[model samples]
Target chain A: MAAYVQDAIMLLGDSLTQGGWEAHGFAQRLSYVYARKLDVINRGLGGYQTDWAIPVFEQIFAKEHEQHHVPKVRLLTIWYGANDASPAPSPQHVPRDRYKTNLSHLIHMVTSPASAWYSPDTRIILITPPPVNTYQWDGRVFDATKSYAEAVKEVGLKENIPVADVWTEIWEAAGKDEKSCERFLSDGLHLNAAGYEIIFNTLIKIIGENYPELHYDKLQNVFVPWSEVNVADPRPSLVKRPAMIGLAQL
Target chain B: MAAYVQDAIMLLGDSLTQGGWEAHGFAQRLSYVYARKLDVINRGLGGYQTDWAIPVFEQIFAKEHEQHHVPKVRLLTIWYGANDASPAPSPQHVPRDRYKTNLSHLIHMVTSPASAWYSPDTRIILITPPPVNTYQWDGRVFDATKSYAEAVKEVGLKENIPVADVWTEIWEAAGKDEKSCERFLSDGLHLNAAGYEIIFNTLIKIIGENYPELHYDKLQNVFVPWSEVNVADPRPSLVKRPAMIGLAQL
Candidate 1:
């Protein structure tokens, strides 16, 4: 076993991120790529707006602050806007103005030294929501969501943070075909496997280009491979030590 | 937030269990089925034999015993033999006599009150490694694996724990078709998606029949739904307080 647990990629967002439960979705695929290297923690809170996520973030950071000799979070993803972009008639709506401010506030809390889990080492990425096809989604919400996506882009620029502009990526992949775009969203809101594939590939590509060290191949796998273990004294090779064997034998 | 985190179904084994990284693999499917109900912890140690797994189990159980107020593990699966079945000269080889004794010891450590992390309420399971085709696996090891499978069944009968009996199940499912059998084993030793599908479905059926309470729908999702939240005072609903809002809105 290795001497330490693996760090994690924190997936923090709303319903879109929640759809990651499917085996082929972004969450599982990323977990697979990083099999022994990282633990992917999904904190997707579907139907939630930024206002509520703030406190949730605070709670998580508080817990991590006290944790020592544990897997530190190396990457955090902030993806939202689906619920916040809900039209006025919907209970989930958070006005675009507040959404923009909340995005900035959330970023500051993580990167700023004043924050509870203050560490400049972790890379934070902002993900903008993709456009919902009006034919399947609420027209009002779809229109409003576009603005929210743009607002997210603006926050990324202002905060000097890496942003996975998923909205443009998906639309371009869909080309001009309306039916093709529909293929990306199961209900014109939440992503289908294809949608998640795009997100997964994009995230992998972005990390490969910008934060290459966080790539799956580069990150450390916790345990020493069984082949590498001192067969006579495997006990000393445990994960806390570095000789624990991973099931994948990767 | 949920007042408490979800319990887990622990998948412990060798390379076969490690194949659960796929979307349709037993791990992902179980996690999806238990989406908001329970967390599926994959503890598959690829390329390991029963003899090697002993210390790893001790390290794990030791950690869980002291974690008060944390999510409890309701199920534990012990799968092995593939690597142990390797023929003499193979570094993974473990004699049948030692394998059987090691399995019994591992089970006792988990269920016996004398051991740490003992929770009589938790259910333990033993999974036999499936028959390996000689063409794919080393001929000597393949023959030995059959005996190991039988040994697992014997242990299950003695311990009175549920066994997936995967070895028999796969051959029976293949009927008379050799190609059908090949579909389940991607490699001579490890399972393909089809093989894992059989494991996933079989586990679901077993849990459905014997432990219906553990069913996903029956288990409570942590925290309240967004609609249930008091818009004025959402903090009252955090996970530690039973007011957590799930991102999936499940």
Candidate 2:
């Protein structure tokens, strides 16, 4: 009935996309901005890794395709890898080799001919995991988040998919203000509402340029609160601790 | 510093657990009731099935053991299997066998030695998927919800897990009241705030008996108004319709 097919974007990731902080996360924001033309389905789990996401892709998305006439998902955004860096029991870390394998598998599933629901025209966007703030590292291997992000970028390049380097953006932004890194994260790992806004704006810029017809203007702006965004103070000096025993204590 | 280990009750499931309804659903209510004694972590995702929940378990609970120094979760309540039965493409219905397999996998994961972070005393409660009111049917597979609920019950029996038959309770209450059923469900599938209250009360009755030490009495009662709860209208004869004139009269 229309000149062009409607765009349906499937957001697959962890807690970041799940609208944790007041339901104003990037996924909901993007939905608002592109509401008229784009149908966005947020399939994000709060604590999930690439390996876990793989099974979800199979169980939920694959299963959906097998059962119903699912609408063609034009854009597939894979934003994961945060939890993978954490020290965990599942051993589902984003090791370089495993990361590549997982990314390739995901791309294959969406672009494969066997995937009746997915078309060749479907555009897949791979977003690197965000940088972990220093506060998140309570003696854990939080620094490995960078390695995971690098691995994701490698896979994106090898697979010829568009990659959004969210890691670099956040890292650069934090480099200027080391004191407030912890505030950007809700639980030292996952992004709070403010962090989600940064990612949302980055995504809009990328998607808007590629698909101008999406008319992203219709959706509501989620990240315009530049002044109100509070960054947490990361320094112990800034903390108002109770005064320790002084000379007066004798 | 405390006498016994601090009890942590983790609620894992779909929209029902996510408190899709208005009054913060059962978990929030329970948190208030238990207050300081129990730390209630709500790990609910809207539209999540049992298969999807398994991965989340691996990330949030299983992975952060050594870092957090949190010894173990005292209790876990898993409520899922709703989205699995809703309409789909190839496997429109979750074959009973596959459903059982998924449930068993979940139970095994929780009880197995692999879950070392959780104490052996960790109690797992499996809740039967709630009923789908016939009146709420949007001409889809609303009838299939009963079978899905049955599948969950069978899994609970086989796994030797505590089962809360919410389906039976709700279905019996909505019997013969089609309009009442419609009012309860926001869609034919998910509950509105009012619908969650019925589930919350049912869960409290079961949990209260098992863990009296948890102390649910102090929780503020966030009851839905009687006018809000759906009650069926029996009289269909009072309706008026437009008169149809015969072609001869025209």
Candidate 3:
């Protein structure tokens, strides 16, 4: 009964979405759980910061319009900011002020003249990045996740958009289980399948509460167990049953 | 001059480098232009077929090594295949492949095994994808690039790599305003940057050949023109200037 269920949902984030895990990772699960109804597009790049995300967004919008003839974006869930916290190769990061600037620009792009070719009724959901586990320190002092989370929250508040504080939830979750930090993140930064599941569920919950029309059924309840999900090599094969399960099967 | 430059050189290739661009790509360019104080690492992701580049290489490698301790992969260049010739969103498009595999695996991870960990011998380069501009356009084709160049060769091949083909060179270059359509690419297939440059240089020779190595010059005369370098954003302010550039300036 989610409101945005009928709308095309675009998941815009960084590595989290890009690394489609087994049963987790919000995008994959959402597509599986929702199947057939929601036209979900996972436009996530692995090591991208907001700066890079901007251009990607532009390109995606352009392509979508060119191909589909749909101008306005219906719903966008943006989970970025991790890469922005560090001095990575692409220089896609933006320090606090710049981060805010970039976030605002993204908002404007989806809602303003630049995105005029698209739908005006776009609802943007900003998900704060999950916390970085301090268990594996790489010598940087500040918690990149926390700093980025705060920046995202600031933007959500200023923009009057719905914000999901995934950072606090993850921080507390990791804090409770100090022994298994690896459970949450495969790497210190990126989330594993389990971590993605937690995120996917959280987003589902948020969407269910906020937008009732989405009709997001709990995939765990409706679909087969994760073990039977048929995660064979994603490579397209000639065999009839390649141990692979498409989103429709979910 | 010196037994293949002490500086690390990356001789990246696809199944094509497995073929050979001989006079056109980074291999030939380094032979002529680069100073003989560098070493090259030819980490070609052969038969790699786009979407598999990152997850198969960069990510796993990043996880295996420590950041600073990793070898200095000072000079890295890659030329992938005519293999990613599938349909759009069907695991063949460059952007999707980059998002799913290449960029995440290679570009994002700072500690990529493919990189020259702390060896002071690291540098990254991307080559443009070879052209696939010609095919039997019977509307029965899944990937035109596979035959002529639209496959997953535009982005990483064009943007991330230092030297590139991007297919247009042979596409437009061969006919001399006559649209030969078939001369440059063998089987409408691969060519190194050299082949591309044969066309690229013909179009913009001065800018293509000589430009200062503004960023990393520890291994001088290894100049990759700024214009030729296509990153998502190559603006001066976006990235942290490499320390070598500062030293070189001093």
Candidate 4:
């Protein structure tokens, strides 16, 4: 069984977030840096949208009563809108207004004191879907996706959550040219290594700026480093310790 | 808090295993394939040996009483021996005979029903240490490390556990030439992407051949695939389901 040794950074979204496990992807990068500090849980469901994620999140996120039994979600990145921006004919599509409401609902499930899944210790970050490269995939509209990205920012502002605006970041990275975004998008929709590099960097910067205490650099390895291990009697030092710097074990 | 939606593949080992979170490393590859099917929990502590690991594993691996509260560790990979092979002068060194005993003890902790941490559902795989290139690094002797690798295989056989002979695999891949292992190893000790590719492929092959039920291909996503979702009434379909194929929810 997987014990609750370390708190976790949960990434919740669609294929974009699921694909974060790819080599050089944002999830992989976070896992590397947070190796002994925090576990990164990728909850990204491919081809799913805000509407569908609502029910799934409810089942995956432990409620207040179940807190002690599970690992604390110290950091959560809600990256959606990619599938929600799909055309009207697509089942994945969620209208911009509903998308915003769904995003807020997911956030409130943890942030709201009255909610069943209230977790005051969990810090939330909202990530806008990357700009769609319509030329590469005809499944989505460029302007439509851009509007959805805008909606994500608006929700972030209202919810008072930090937002990693991947849309604007990639848009600017591509010099605002839609076709040029191919450099980042693997299939006009999902991100490639270069695109994930941008997401990882932006996400880390946001973590450093907002949740500095949770940054990998600010934390210690849950176990003492090798050289620090007491050779003659290591059991005392080998016990799992808290990663938070200067924080005594509870 | 993270709910126990899917079972997990827990990797327990040293830096060689902790480094698996690196780009193209075994951990990342496993996470990608097992995305929704299973969660990959890396309990890899860098610079750790079996001596130090026993205590840490006791704390990290859920005991019998705590099993219901945590994710079921369907597959557990026990990879160690790199640091333990250090020569007599080094504090990390654990003699070959004692090393074998330690490995067996770790296995018994999960397999032995009498043990406090006994977990019948957890399947274990033992991986030997890679060959050391003395020309590149003086920290470990080539023959010394080879003996340790041999020790792992002996333990695996004595315990009737499958062994992923990484030592022999990489050594053969290097054409029995110690210096040529540089292609796989980043430094003389750590693995690079190429080295990890070999580990990932080997590990997956072991899973496929020995534990096909737990293989990524045979398992279904905890949540139904997006295309299969019931569009009109998705809540019933959105619930987290077991990943084992043809197996009804318990």
lDDT of each: 0.72, 0.56, 0.48, 0.92
DockQ of each: 0.34, 0.02, 0.02, 0.90
**How does chain A of candidate 2 score by TM-score against the true chain A?**
0.74
In terms of lDDT, the poorest run of 10 residues in model 2 chain A is A241-250
Error of 3 at B147 (Å): 37
Sorted by TM-score (best first), the order is 4, 1, 2, 3
Question: Which candidate, 1 or 2, would have the higher DockQ against the true structure?
Answer: 1
TM-score of every candidate: 0.88, 0.42, 0.42, 0.99
Write one digit per residue (lDDT tens) for candidate 1, span A4-50: 23456778888777668686888889867776567666767668789
Q: Write the per-residue lDDT of candidate 4 for residues A1-250, one digit (tens) a residue.
A: 9788898999999999999999999999999999999999999999999999999999899999999889899999999898999999799999999999999999999999999999999999999999999899988899999999999999999999999998999999999999999999999999999999999999999999999998999988888898899999899988777888776672
Q: Of the pair 1 and 3, which is ahead by lDDT?
A: 1
- The backbone clash count of each candidate, in order, is 29, 12, 68, 0
DockQ of candidate 1 is 0.34
What does candidate 4's lDDT look like per residue over B1-250, in tens digits?
A: 9998889999999999999999999999999999998999998888889899899998999989999888999999999899999987788888899999999999999999899999998999999999988878778899988999999999999999999999998999999999999998988998999999889889988998999899898998898889999999999988888999776673
DockQ of candidate 4 against the true complex: 0.90
- Residue A44, candidate 4: C-alpha displacement in angstroms: 0.6
Deviation in Å, model 4, residue B179 alpha carbon: 1.2
lDDT of 3 at A210: 71
Once fitted onto the true fold, the runs of candidate 3 whose alpha carbons sit more than 4 angstroms away are A1-7, A21-23, A62-73, A87-92, A113-118, A137-142, A176-180, A217-250, B1-250
lDDT (tens digit, per residue) of candidate 3 on B1-250: 0001123344544545433323344333332233222322333433445445543343213233342222234445545545545345544334434433563355444334454322223344444454453462222132444342332344445434343444555545655321254455544455534454563343223224432341223333222222333465444322222223434321
Better of 1 and 4 by DockQ: 4
